[model samples]
Structures are given as C-alpha cells and as structure tokens.
Target chain A: MTDALVLLVVVPIAASLFPVALGGRFERIGWFVAAAMGLVHLGLSATVAAQVLESGVISYAVGGFEPPFGIELVADGVSAPLLVLVSLSTLGVLAYARRAGPHSNAFYSELALLTAGISGVFATADVFNLYVFLEITGLATYALVASGRSPRAALASLKYLFVGTIGASLYLLGVGYLYIMTGTLNMADLTGAVASVGYTSPAILTSFGLIVTGLLVKVAVFPLHTWQPGAYAESPDTVSAYISALVSTAAAYALVRIIYAVYTTKFLDEISLAGDALVALASVSIVVGAVLAVMQSDLKRMLAYSSVSQFGLVVAAIGLANETALVGAVVHLVGHAVMKGGLFLTVGVFATGLGVRTVEDFAGLAAKAPISSAAFAVLAFSMVGIPPAVGFVGKWNIVVGAVEAGAWSVAAVVVVSTLLTLAYFGRVIERMYFTAPEPEADAVSTDGGNDAVEVSFGMRAVVVVSAVAAVVLGVLGSDLITVIQPALEVYF
Target chain B: MIDLLTTHYNYIASILLFGIGLYVVMGSPNLVKKIIGMNIFQVGIFLFFVTTGYVDGGAPPVVGHGEETFVSPLPHVLILTAIVVGVSLTAVALALVIRIYDGYGSLDEDVIKEVQVDD
Candidate 1:
C-alpha cells in the first residue's frame, strides 16, 4: 500500500526505542530485535519499491493532509533503490556485527535509529523534514562512531559531529532561503516556485550553493572529507561497514533528489558555474581519493579513501545531469555501497580472525582465510572495474553517460580513476595471492596465531554474499535501468 | 548601504553570528569552545528562520484568532524541531568530550592530538 511509505520510516524509529528500553535484562537480545526489525523494514521497503516501480511515484500526505501545506512522503525509482540499500545494509552489517562487536543494546538501538534516519531522508518530500532526518542520521552515526573501545573513536566522533552538524545546519539555512523566496518547503511545490523566481535570481542561486555545499560535506567529497577516514577507520568494524555503505550513500542520494526534483535541469543549463563546480570537485575527489587510498597501509583507511573516489564518480554523474549520467549515478551509487561495504566487512573478518588490519598484513591471506580472501579479491577486482561485477557496470554506465553529455573530462577521469582504483586494489590482490606469509606474522597476529583464528559463519557468509550480489547486480544492470527509466523520465 | 543595513539588520546580524561561530569552531584549540561555537552557529540559523516567519504588525498564528496578518507558523515549527535536534547533538558531543578528557587527561585539541599520536 502507498501508506507503507510512511511505515518504512516510522516502524524503525519506534523499534529503535525497544532495545534501549529492554537493555538491562535483554542486553544480548538487542541483535535479535534489530535483526527482526531489519527484516520488517526490508519487507516494507520492498513493498514500497514494488508499488512505485509498477505504477509511478507514490506520494502520501501524512495524516491525510494535502501537499504544499502538510508534509509528504514520496517513493519513486530513485528512492526505492536507496531505501532497499539502507535496509539491506542494516541487515547485512548486523549479521557481521553479531560476533564482531560492541554488541550493546545501545549500539543496536543506534543502528535502528540510523536505518530510520536514512529511510526518512529517502522518503521525505519536504526540505526541512530532510534536515531533521539528516540530524537524526548524524546523531546516530556520531554515537556509533564513538561506540568503539578507543578514546580516539570519541575524538573522531566529536570531529564528525562538529563538521556534520555544520553541514546539516547549512542545508537548513539553504531551506530557509528557499522558504523565504518561494514561501514553500515541499519539493514538488518548490520546483515551480523556484522556477518562477528565476534560476538566475540571487536568492535562488545562494540557496543552491548553500544546499549543495552542505550535502557535499556529508558526502565527504574531497576537501570536505577530513572527518571520514578517521571515523571510518576508528569505529567498530560493523559500524565502519554499515556507515561506509549507507551514510554517504544516503547523502549522495539526497544530492540527486535535490538537484533533479527541486532545482531541475533548467537551473543547471542557466547557470554553468553550478555544474562546472560540481564536476571540478568530483574530478579532484576521484584523483585525490585514489592517490590517498594507495598511500594507506591501514586497510580500513584505504577503503575510506576509496569511498571518497567512488562517491566522486557518483557526484560527477549527478553533475553531468543527462539521462544516461543520472542512470550511471544511481547504478554506481548502489554498486559502490555493496562493493565497499563488502570490502570493509572482509577486512573485519581478517582483523578479527587473523589480526590482520593493514595492507602488509594481507600477504598470503588466501592460505588462512580462503573464503574471505577470495571475496576480498573479487570485490577489489570488481572495484577495479572488472567485467560482470557491479563496479564495472556502474563505471561503464557513468563513462558512457559522461560521453553522452559531452563531459569528456569526466569520462576521462572515470577511465583514469579505474586505473587508479587498480593501483590500490591491485597491490592488495598481489599481497593476498602472490607474496609469502611474513615469517614474523605469527608474532604480529593480534589473536596469537592463524591456528587460533576463528571467524564466525555469519561474517563469512555476508561478505561472500555481497561479492556475489556485486556480480549478479551487474548482470541485471539493464533490468535496473528499465525499472528506473520511468522515474527518470518525469525529471529529464 | 545604510538603508539596506537598516532594512535587513537581522539578516546581517545572523550572518555575523554565523561567521563568528564558524571562526570559533575552526580557530579555537579548546574542545569545549568548539561545542560552544557549534551551539552559537545553530542559534544563528534558528534566528534566521524565526526572522523569516516574522511579519510587521502580525498577530500570532493561532486558529480562529481572526488576525488579518498572521506570521507564518511553519518556520517556527521547523525551528522548534531543529532546536530539539541541536540540544541532542550538544548532549552527545559533550558526552564524547567527557570520555575524551578521561582518556587523555586534557581538553585542549592540540594536546589531545599530541597525546593521540604518542599513543
């Protein structure tokens, strides 16, 4: 039912409180509650996606209030994929976190809250409502990042809180500007209201600047990405994989929603500066992210940097603003989340089972943990744009989209960044398969030795499943494009 | 310039508050100061939203109050929600700061970084 759209956000939020309320007696029960809620959330997300894909965009006014006055929850092709991603990643990460954990009622509660926040962001039709959800996501994420054992995690989380709050506030300020100019907060209503004010108007331009800039910080695009690597690297492994997959992905998805739904392509056409700046930053992020990723010895930090590059492609696709490019952006967004999240989980398996946390520690990993190593290699190669993997599918679409839009520079960067991707992932692959295990690795292994290493069935299954999904989704790329086409038509 | 300032003094003041808050957050070495700066920055945005909802000689937006010009109630509602969000964020931030202080025995950002590296 269309009403399921609101349920997608509301159910998780209400469920999030249960874990904390039952904390003292049911400490370990948090995972079970979260898992159960995640399943329900996934079902709700699927129902919404199916209805939207079958029909068109599904818009629901909360409590039967009409749009442009009361808040609206919307789900279309764009949101459907992200909604599913948020739920799926939540479920997947909970599986991995079952054994590898800060397994507190509090942690699961935060995870459920994050699920609620991200789903809310995807579902909301009001700009100010988007801000509230962004904060909710921000708060949950900051807490999760701090949930790590180290004091460093608290510092990383604090830094993230400060930067992330500023970004969200800036977005709110932009909403304020838009509200003053158009006297409306609803995305659908603001589209017409913004156009009537003229794209070239100073207020409209300022709002666009503020909104996009704010979101870019959340997306961790290049220069604004300072809080990301530390947050990703320092957090508990489950937290890293979960946030790495969904948080920035949700923010980037919001970027797409705002650009297409509210500003429309006409604004980009009128203002060359806007599109150019986005493209420029994205290009820089791609190159710099890859370069930094290659320089990292820490595996988690490497993946964090790699996310910056991958999201660059997504943002670049959004900036290209063509039908094909937008398709590429969505495909890449989904692909990157799966691939990167899988990679982080795989790294966690190594860290937990083998005490291996650095690129150097990856040498001869295939011998000890064949399944995870193979999965890691598969994901890494997929990230390098190997065929039949979702990563290659996403990159191919983005490159084709970039060329179609005459964005030769972006296309070239897409190609070059693949090689840059290879440069980083390749070394890990080489270490995994080719190099001999270090003689002193036994001394270096955090758990004592390879003999003592014991990875749970759940952790191994999730990473392997993600690797398989990356390949399968790539094969089904055309079907995905077909499903999303109708939604794209409404905008382009 | 004077006329513009007179007409939009609230806007100007809000912008100034925004800039000052940002400067303190970025420029200060103290951890607590950063959180204070964050609150100030949020308050600036709240002020801007409230200013936008204001109307000259407007009555409060109460149902059936029968005022010809009533201030827009939406922005105020949104700001109320944001203020709640801001308070939660501050609470979480200070909790982290306390943990950080207990761990490293200092509240200075530079000192914490130094201690962190030494760890």
Candidate 2:
C-alpha cells in the first residue's frame, strides 16, 4: 500500500527533473513528459483509492520503520478521496495547460513539483512532514506565479512568498510547541499527549492559536487573504486556474486534519474558544469576501475574492464540528474545486482567445465563445447553489448541519452567504446571456497587453468536462458520502 | 518570577527575535529587508526547536557501548529539514525580488505597487 502512496508523490517529483534534461533537444518535450507523469499519477491514485475503499485503513511506514519513529503514509477514508481529487485536478490542469501555456520546460517542471507537493500533503501522517510538504507547495506556487514573466507577476509572487513564508514559519513554531509539550511529531501520538497535558494549558492553547493562524492564512480566510487576489490576477492564466482549485483546498483540508485528527473533537469540547474564534472569523469572511468580489471589475480577481468566501463556508462547517457539517465541508470542497477551477479556465479562454479580462469586456461572451460562456454560466449556477448541482447539495448539508448543531447564527450566515454569492455572479450571468457585445470600444482596458493567443481544443474540452462533472458529482453526492462514511464515523 | 526569567532565557531570546522579525516584515516598505525579516523569523523557529531538544545534563545522540541518557535527536533532524526548506523559500523570494527590481527599477513596495496601478 505504501508503494502506491510513495509512487503517487515520487512520480511527479522525479519526472519533473526529466523536462530540463530532455527539453534541451526537443523544445516541447516538457509537455509530453508532464502529461505522461500526470496520467501515471492519476492511475496510481485510483488504484490506491480502490484498495483503501475495499479494505480498511492502510498505514505504511516509510523506510521499514514503525510509526512514532519513521514517517508513515496513511490511505484511509479521510485521505483516499482527496488523493483522487488532487490527482484528477492535476491531470485536468495538464490538459488545459497544453493549449494555454507559459509553454516553457520550467513551467511544466513547477507543475510537476506542485502535483507532488499536494499529494504529499494529502497522505502524510506526520505533523512535521505536513509542514515540509506545505513549504514545497508554497515554493512551487511562488515559482509558477512568477512564470508569467511580467513585472506585476514578479511583484505578486514576491508578496506571496513573504506572506507564505511567515505562515509556514508560524506553523513550524506551533509544531515546536507541540513537540515541547508532547515530545512527539506523529499525529496519533499527539492526541494522547495533548490530552495528558490538558487542552487548557497555556502552551497547548498558544500552539493551537499559532497553528490555526498559519492555516487560515494559507486557506485565504478573509482579512489574512491579501496575497490571493494579486497572485491569482497577475499570474499566467493556467497557473491561476490550477492553484485556485487546489492550493487553498489542500490547506483547508489540512485545517480539517488539525481540528479533527491532531486536536480531536474532545479538545474543542474542552475549550470552546478554539472553535468559536474560527467560527467568528469564517462568518466575517463569508460576507466580506462576497462584498469584495462584487467590487472587482477584473474577472480573475473577482473569482479570487469569491474563493475567500467559498472557503469561508468550508471553515465554518469545520468550526461547527458536527458530523453532517464536516460532510458538507468535504462536499463543498470538491464542488468548489471543480466549479472555481472551471471558471478560471473559462476566464483563461476569454483572456487568451478574445482579450477579455474585465466583466464588462465579457459582454455577450455567449455569442463570441459560446461553449465556454455556457460552461461559465453552468459553473456559476452551481456556485450559486442551484438545485441538483454539487454546490447546492453541499450548501444544503452545511445549513442543515449548522441547524442541527444549534449554531443558529452560523446557519443564518450560511443561508445569507448563498444570496451574497449570487449577487456577485448574477451580474456576470446576466451580461453573458442577455447583454449584446459592445462593438469594439477603444477604452483603455486594464488587461496586460499580450492577447489573442490561439485557444486549443484541449483547453475548451477541460472546461466543458469540469462543468459537466460539477453537475454529475452533485447528483452522485449521496453515493460519494457512503464512500467517506466509514472514515467519517471513525473521525467524529 | 526571577526563577522563571533565569530558567527560560533561551525561550525569551527566541521570542524577542520573533517579535523583531515580525515588526520588520510588517512595518518596512523595502522588499529585500522584508525577505531578511522572513529569514530572521525562520531563525527564531529553528532556535526554538533546537532549544526544545536540549537536556540539562545529557550526552549527544550517539551510541556508546553502554546505556546512556541523551537529548532527543528527532527535533534536530526535523530542524535540519526545516532549515533546508527555509533556504529554498528564501531563494525563491529573492529571485522574485530581483525580477521586480529589474521591471520597476525600485525595491520599495509602495513605489512598485503604485507603478502596477498606473500601468
């Protein structure tokens, strides 16, 4: 079992080295190599997920040593689906990047590195290992952000690096506290040790505070999310879509792990402040992110702000700390990745193909780029929580879960946040479907001057497929729950 | 209070370094200094981890022919890995700063951001 787990991370990382070696002779060999690795990683993850589902949890210690000593890779109900999710998204990004690319050998190398880092995040059972993978992911993201080769991209990436480093440092400091108190780095050992030390100890509380702060910054929760918009807006199109879908999704998943796996629900029960503080922050993020998204004229920046709000819903569900709410968190997580990733891809198509970047520039996009505009609308509706879409189902479960948990205010915020989401996307939808394309205005648009690159069939295909998947996963949400149910039972 | 201060001086020093790094990172407008601040912050975390691995009267984590008390080696190994990561992160950040400087001809955050808005 550890074989597949190790292979899933090692494949992409090891393959990334090949592009530089081979690309010296063949210019676009990076494309073929990355695609091959992505395909292999996807197959390995599917096999691993199937094995985990059929049997129970599988924990394989690396280097033939047992846990609490050697690092362990676990593929249980919790991480198996996420393994599938990150792999699928990586492959989808590869497909999209083939058409719309920075097209450098180094570009695919960073993509491969990012894929390896995320899979490691999804599977590692050691807390310090998680920090290592987090930095790896941050480094890849910083490089990829600068790959756009613009001054703005460089500055944005620099800002991202500064903020991301501080966040990771805070997390390392928290791990230091955990080690000092418990003298263990393994997640399983942490639970018993944390309980023995008492959850209310000032040291334990401070560690929890630092850990959550670092994760929230990574998660891009409201006020701490300053780096997100610039990085997303200024990066090359494919990088924006890829990181938007997975970076925060992986970080949010880590937050779930910390809350439930490392700290445990009992910890939250002992000290409600730990949970309450997160809930308050999430509630503010939901409103503030939506309001900010509404103000952004740039489509990609608007989508970036929308992510702040969407992740707020996920974190709120996490803070509720109920079984159903947690389920909603996972569902919304999967749903948001597909929908938001698809939206960014569509924006990429518009930006590269037609020089459209602003919302106004998207006037009557239906007539110009019909399939992608339709794809955009479908994903937007899903994001708005329309019925039978994955988005609606995730929101339904979360609202019901919040009510069941008697967090009346949280339930209210969840409901209101849905309307706020529609408010921002509604105008874009209206303009796409109803408004006619303005006849070639000469107004100084804010889009960076490089425009009208050829859009390939693979780029459009990836967008359509993700849009369809959002609807399909919505219908199959209940079956997906059955798969995660076993892990959830143990987790809660 | 006197005993607490005397006994925990290493911890207090680490905290002071952390606070100074935080202030420089948040308060300064210079991009390169901010990166230096980031490095200082990581140094604080590394110091904290190393301090936790210290023992009052214990041998280093190497084997003798007999039973012996030793400070834990796990945190040392963990800190080594973390320091590598910190180095790589600094490399990436400095690379970006170089590019930004090349593009805007200024290393000031305020000037670079203002230029981005104007463009």
Candidate 3:
C-alpha cells in the first residue's frame, strides 16, 4: 500500500526543481537539497526493499489508477535491491562530491533528475514509460557530462548525446512495433501479447533486433562503445563515477526486465537465435573490452572499457538463461557498480590531490598517496576476481551456471574473463607497489611547498568504504540471494 | 509492385527518411548537419508510430456520443512526449556544438579531433 515506489522517483525530481525555482534567495542550494533528498530517498528505498522482502511484490499504480491503463511501479526481489543500490550510490556520490565538488545548484539538480530517471527505469512496468525515463536519464547524463568546464567535456558529451539518441530512438521504434502488434503498453500484458503474436513472426523479430540493439548501444557493447571512453575520460571525476556506476547498470537492468518479463523464457525457447546472439556478443565484449582496457594509458578510459567487459559478463549470464546465472548477473551488476565506482573515486582523489590522470602517472603511487593507492588496489583486486570479494562470488556463480547449462564456450569465457581482468588491473597495481617514486615532483604538483598531497578525509573515506563493501557485500552474497530468490522465482 | 508501394507507402517513406538521416549523420563532417540528421531520424520514427495508428477512414481519436470507432490515440500521445524529448536533445546538441566551435574555431569533428590531438 506504500506509495514509496512512485515517491522514489517523485521526491528527487521534486527536490531537483527547488534549487532552480527557489535558489535565488538562498546561496549555494544544490548540495544541501541533493544531500537531504538523497537521505530521504535512501530511507524510502530501504523501506520499499523491506516491504518487498516481507510481502512479495509491492506495486503502486500511479494516481491509484489500476494498472494496464495507468503506469504501475513495482518493487520486488528483482527491483528492490537495485532500487536501494541506485539511491545508496547516489547518496555515496553526493558525499564524495560534497568536498570534491562542482557543487553548483544546476549540477545537483541534474544529478537529482538522473536519480529520479534511474529509479523510474527500475520501477516502471510500462514499456513506453521506460523509454521516457531512459531518455530522461540520457538527457540528464549528457548535460552532466558537459557540466565539466572544458571543451573536450562538451565534445564528449555531444558524442554521447548523438549515440544515446539513436539508441533510444531504436528502442522507441521497437516499442512502436510492439504496440502495433500487441496494442498494450504494460509489460505484464505485453508478455501475454508477445506470446500470442508468436515469437517467430517478422514483427516480433524486428522488435527484438531494434530493442536489443538500442539497449546494447546504451550498455556500450563492443563496437557500439565508441562514445563511452571519451565520455568517461573527459567528464569531471565525480560525474563520471555517478554515471559509470548507475547509468549502464540501469540499462542492463532494463534488458533483464525486457528479456525475462516482457518476452519471457517462452520467447527464448522459440527463438534461440536471440539468446545465442546475445551470448556471442557478450563473449566478444568480455574479451575485447579487457583488451581495450589493457591498451589504454588513460586511467578513466581504461575503467570505462572495463565496464564494457563487466557488463559483458552480466549480459552473458543473462544469455546463459539459468537460475544461477541470472542471479549471478544481478550480483555482478551490483558488484561491478561498487568496485568500479570506488576505483573512479580513488582516481579522482589521485587527480585532485596529486595530478595523476594517466596510468604512467600512477608510478610510485604507494609512496606518495598510500591510502588512495591502497583503496585502488583493493577495488582492483576485487575487480580482478579475488576470492571472498564480491567480484569473485559473482564470477563463480556465472561460471558455475554456464557449466551447468553445458554452454562450455560461455563457461570458458566467464572463467577466462578473470585472467583478462587481471591483465589490465595488474599493471596499475604493479606500478603502484613495485615502482619507485620520482622525487620532488609530487610535492610541487599538489602544493607549492614540501608537504604531502591534500587528499580530503571524505575522499579517503568513500574509497575505503567502497573497498570494504566490495568484500563485505561479497560475504553477504548468500543473504542477497535469499532476498533475490522470491523475485527470481516469479520472473522465471 | 505498384500496389505494395501505394498501400504501404507511409512505411516506405518512413524507412527512406530514416536511411537518409542515417546517411547524413554518418557521412557528414559538419556537426550541425549531424544534429539535423538526428532530428530527421527522430521525425522519421515518429511518422512510423503515427502510421501504425492510422485506420482506414477513422476519425481523429475523438470520442463522440455513441461512437463505436476511432484511431488509436496511444501512439500519438507517446510520440508527443518523444517529440519533446527530441527537442531537448537538439537543444543540448547545439549547445555543445557551439562550445566546440568556440574552443577550436571549427564545427568539423575531424578538425576538432586534429586540434585536440595536437594539443
């Protein structure tokens, strides 16, 4: 009976408008408003998760208009964790941004809007509403990427804009076909409609191609990932962390939704090519993304490409189409968000305090900025699939699931992906610990005197906290599975 | 052939429009032209949705007293929202193009890339 699901989106959006509409009287309104609303949002999403855990799925129809006619917001085992993750990460990024900040009211507004859009993407049950929210997320992302006061950031943002628009448009076209064929916009209704229309129809085939391609572009799969590196590399560190953690995570979530909910396992049973192509594509992304990550000298760009690969694993798990793998996909999604985002924040600390933006610049990082370097090492190892870390748990589930399914090739890729991950992250770790510092350079760059770099307490805490969560959440994966079991059973 | 062309001409036109837009977006070097192409692409997709709702001789989705039939209004409403989203995208794209032109004195992405490389 709680409207928490709707308010999950509405609260942030409502707060987002305040800094713009009423900020003239108040000075520096963005961070306060964002932080306050973020806290409320975190609490609310936690409540929603608790409710969903106790009572199956919690569905809130907008304006109390019964579903199928009006939009319905559902929080179940599937969406509840992601809802908490989205709000929690938004608040975390806000905390990191508090000290390391663009701190403008407009920036906070866009961040809030992005939060709202992501929550909507997670909660909405209607296909068209997903598109609207997707665009909202994209639009907010482009503006936020451009919020960095540099020309390259603008260019990168523009590039992201064009690619993202096409991706979204293709999705809209898919929806058009779906509507034309089925005449219902609701996801649950579409599941029945799609089956009744038959899985192998030309229209259904076209819808699949357009819809999956559209989402793949957003997810930044293999060749479609051109805009990603530039966008991640050029944006301000905080903004990159926010988008990197949430944007594609939400997109991947949508893909899982459409595959499991709208199309259903029945669709996969009929058109095996859909699942096969996804597996093939994700495997390619896994290998190629790691290769690209190894090739990049730019640290943020490397992280961006790593994301392409991590998401590849999730996509592949979904492609595997088993109970264990699907759960593995969800775990990996959350694991990557925590580890990758923490990596970005640590990099931000490196850049702000020590002017280290490139991999080569990370030389002797342990000697100068030990805390940040240590935090980076922890996240990097977690990302490299160190056992007992959440990353390892996710990889293990996917590999085991792939093996159980007798998809030997997919299983091999899921296993080999660990070594591929290490190949890139290993270099950074090596540089940090094994190399000697170039003396007199570090002290001059951060401050004009002979003093250590000024890495803020907040910056250090966030990095440490995420590194800690990377391990702690891993140990709690079994608990996570219990919470997710109900949602998984219903979807399957 | 002629029968297929006329009855499904709207779909054909929409596809053609999309192809043209795609070509312009991919082929052109001018950043603004790319944005224009993007706009055309969106409008093309909008037409595709509108065409789906078109019923033979059905009145505009208005409900009159005891009326039994009308065109589907759902896609139309969806497209309206999409059109607004499209507009905002264009605005942001133009703003970015302006900033790039200001920074590098060129709207050609190749030239901008070159300058960025040199820097």
Candidate 4:
C-alpha cells in the first residue's frame, strides 16, 4: 500500500508496451488488456487516496535515496482526489472506447502511456520530473489526436506538437533558472530556498513569469489557445473526452501546486504584481472565452472554448491565494473535469446515434435520443451553476473568496461567467427541447451509409454516471474541503 | 555594459541563440524550418543549463582525482537527459512534418492552409 504511488505510474507505463508486443494472435486483446490494467490502476490509486486521507502526506524516496538528493513521489490531500479523478476519468473513457473506437493495439498502448504520464505529473515531488512527465503527456496526446482518420487530424496534431513543445521548453528554462538560484529541484526544498533568496530578486521574478506563462499555454487560456478547438474537434470522440477532462485539468493543478507549494503566498504578498497580473489575465479569458463559445457554430468547438472560460475560474481562484479560494480551485478542477468530460461524451452519443454534430442539427434532439438529451441537459445545467450542482458549489466558493479578498472586479467577473455560460448552453438547450427537428434530417447522414448507427450501452452509461457524479459531488463539496483542509494548512 | 557582457558571455550567447530560434519559429512559414528552430531553441536552453555548473579551474567530476575543486556534475547529468528528450522530440516533430508533406503535398504553412480551405 505504501508503494502504491510509484506503482500507479510504473504499472501503466510497463503495461503499455505489452499491448504493442502482443502482435499477431493477441491483437484484439488490447482493449481487454487496457481495461484490466485500468482496473489495477483504479485499485492502486484508491489505496493511495485512502491512505492519504487517513494519514498525512505520504512521501516515498526512489530506490531508498533520501531527501533533497533523490526523486520523491508524494500523495497529499490536494493530489489524492486528483489521483482518483485521473484513474476514474481514464477508466470511464476506456469503457466508452470499447464500443466506439479505432480499437487498434497501438491506440490502447498510447492510452495507457497517457495514463502513466498524467499519474506521474500528479505524483512527482521534483520539478524536473514534472517537466519530463509533462512532455510524456504532451507526446501521448499528440499521437492520440492524430489517430483520427481525417488528414485534418494530422494538421491539428502537428500544430499542437509545435506549440506544446514550446510550452514545455519554456517551463524547462524556468526550472534551469530556479536551479541556478536555489541549487535544488525538489519542491519542498525549493520552498525554503526561494524565500531565502527574496521574492523581489529579478531572477525569481523572471523564473516565476516564465513558469506561469508556460503553464497557462497548457491550461489553454485565451489568445494562447489557438491549437485547442481544432484538436478537440478533429480527434476521435473518445480522445476528445479523455484529454479534455484530464490534460488541462492536470496543468491547472500543477499551476496551483507551483504557486502555493513552491513560491508560497508570501511571494504573492511581497510581489503584488504577479498575483494581480494572473487575475487580470484570467478575467480577460473568462469574458473572451464565453463570447467565443457563443460565436462557434460547431458543437465540439464551442465546448473547447467553454474549457478556456472554465479554467479561467480555476486560475482566478489560484491567484486569490487564500484557503477558501485554493479549496475552490481544487473543487472546480474536479467539477469541470466531470461536467466537461460528460458533455463531450454526450456529443459523441449524438453524433454516433442521430448523425448530429452541429448546434443546428440538435434541434429537437430530445425526440430521437430522449435519454441522452436529458443527460446532456442535466450536465449543461450543472455547468451553468444551477443550485445543488457541482458547478454552482465551485463558483459560489470562488465568488465569496474573491469578495472576502476585496477583489471586487474578479468577483463580478466570476458572477458574470455563470450567465455567459448559460448564454451558449442555453442556445443548445433551447434548440434541443423547444425547437422542432427539420423534415429532411432523415437524409442528413453525413457518412452516406445506410448501416445502423448504434449508441453503445457503455457510452451512455458513462455520460449518465458523470451527470450523477456532478450533482452528488455538489452536495459533498463541503466534505471535500474538510478532506483538503490539512493540505491547505501547509500552504497558508 | 562591456564588463557585464565579457563576464557573462556564455549567458548572453545562450539567450541570443534562444531569441534567434524563437524568431525563426514564429517567422518561418515552412514546417521543417519551424522544427529546426525548435531544436535550436532547446539546444540554447541546454547550453544555459550546462554552463551554470562551470567553475573557473575545476576538474571534471570524476572522483579519486585528489582534486579539491570539481565542477558540479548534476547540471551535466541533467542536460544529458534533456538532450535525449530533445532528440526524441525532434524525431517526433520530423515524423509529423513528413506526414504533413505527404498529406497536403506542401511543407509551407500558407500552402497547407490554402489546401485545407479548398477541401
């Protein structure tokens, strides 16, 4: 059980190679292998989460090397829930892919590799190890995005590779700067070292600037988010849901970790420009992302834009740098993952069953796919911050935290974001329930095939389960804060 | 200004290399050139990292040399791993570039955009 943190990363990475190695006779067994491994990952992460919640932070030195000299894996209060989220979300997507998939051995291999990479990002206590994991995650994602049949998938993947590599490189440079200043890469050691060097030093300022900017690109903030809409829209539906749920969420979590764990809030208090700049940027992203989402014609593109806006809320919470806001960041990170992942899977259901891909095609979709439409409506309303939903709980905490911090503008922007969320989602909901389906929609099958379009049981179950989890998580939001309170105590 | 440049010439050179790489990546239209630019940019960072470990007259970090002064081997080991990562990244980027060329019959970003629009 103590070794669960390292096993959570190593098991999937080692298993990833097996799928590709099992060539001729065992080709079709890849999904089964991946599924079994997913279960193992779930068990391991659940053990880690239980142990972490019961005790305090669990730290393991690699190969018995101790302290600042060796790489360490940590399972703390903040990372414990995220570890479970990574396992559950990936397992959920794997189930969906069982029915709707490319289903090749190589595809499953990439999926397993991606799981290992994300788990590594969450587990590592070393800054440079985080970079290596970030690159691993980026590499796996690019290949999965390009797994789509269209040539456009190739284009999107390449663009993402270029931009994503640059982002990671910038982060590496920041690490180099820190190493020069503090002579250590361990997160815990850097905390003390950074404070000793003084926050007003130019080297510290530059390093913080580069690190935050690099991560914001990965988080897909507006203006730095050109690669996202195309990648999400062009990839396979399973890929879209998996990456949308985990990738940017992992980056946002890393940002929060870097801000609170490494730099600490004292740096923000001393250098007020840094925190104010983050809040300002996040505020702009909030308004711009919603407006862009409203203007998008394609359903997947709109959802991609919606992520930009949602992450703005998470980043804003991080910038507020108080216990309430920090807890809100963690809550929103999990909430957004469940809601957005569910929304993407629902989009896939519509596309697979009724040949619907655009907002216009969704007119009276309730008649054809009653179950999916209901699930979609529930998830969408949850995203719009209706009371008793996870989205409302997250946004409420952030708004109150901002108000307490006396950042009135940020509080106002967060409130306005709820209505803006309603703006784009409301259009879809209206077309879904209120408007009538077109007469010629029967002939509108874009694939030009007469074969039956089946919506798999696994796919629908995942979407419906996500909606249930969203509302259930909302009611349990306070419990989440209580669990994470110990971790917040270490920070503030 | 001259004293600063002379004293930290390695840092200045690395930053300049990084700047040039960024300019090429953002300015060039060809996909292959963009990837080459990425490599240059990464090498620049590697140089900066490796140079940070250099001491004036310190020997290489092989133990039992009976030398009191030794250049820090940590950054060297780090850059070695970084170099491996850079090579793999370059290989993947080139593979992606080949696929783009095969699919669109062009390596230029502008031409690819026009081809996509026509499709």
Tens-digit lDDT track for model 2 on A206-311?
8999999998999999899999999999998899988999999889988988878889999999899878888999999999999999999999999999999999
RMSD of 3: 1.8
**Stretches of candidate 1 above 4 Å error?**
A446-453
State the local distance difference test value for candidate 3.
Answer: 0.89
Candidate 2 ranges with C-alpha deviation above 4 Å:
A442-452, B65-67
Q: Could you estimate the TM-score for every candidate?
A: 0.98, 0.98, 0.97, 0.98
Which lDDT tens digits does candidate 3 get at residues A1-492? 477888999999899998777678876888899999999999999999989988988888888789898888888897899999988798889889888887678899999999999999999999999999999999999999998988999999999999999999999999899999999989988989999999988998899899989999999988898999889889888999999998999999999999899888878877888899999999999999999999999999999999999999999988877888899899998899899889999999888887877787777889888877888998999998898899988888898989888889998987788898998999999988997766665555556423243567877899999999999999998998888866877666
Computed on C-alphas against the true complex, the DockQ of each candidate is 0.94, 0.91, 0.90, 0.67
Worst 10 residues of 1 chain A by lDDT: A446-455
Question: Considering every candidate listed, which one attains the maximal DockQ?
Answer: 1
DockQ of 4: 0.67
lDDT of 4 by residue, B36-61 (tens): 89888988999999999999899998
Show the colliding residue pairs in model 3: none
Q: Per-candidate TM-score, first chain only?
A: 0.98, 0.98, 0.97, 0.98
Between prediction 2 and prediction 4, the one with superior lDDT is: 4
Write candidate 1's Cα lDDT for B1-119 as tens digits. 99999999999999989999999999999999999999999999999999989999999999898989999888899899999999999999999999999999999999988997997
Model 2 DockQ reads 0.91
**Candidate 3, true inter-chain contacts retained:** 0.88
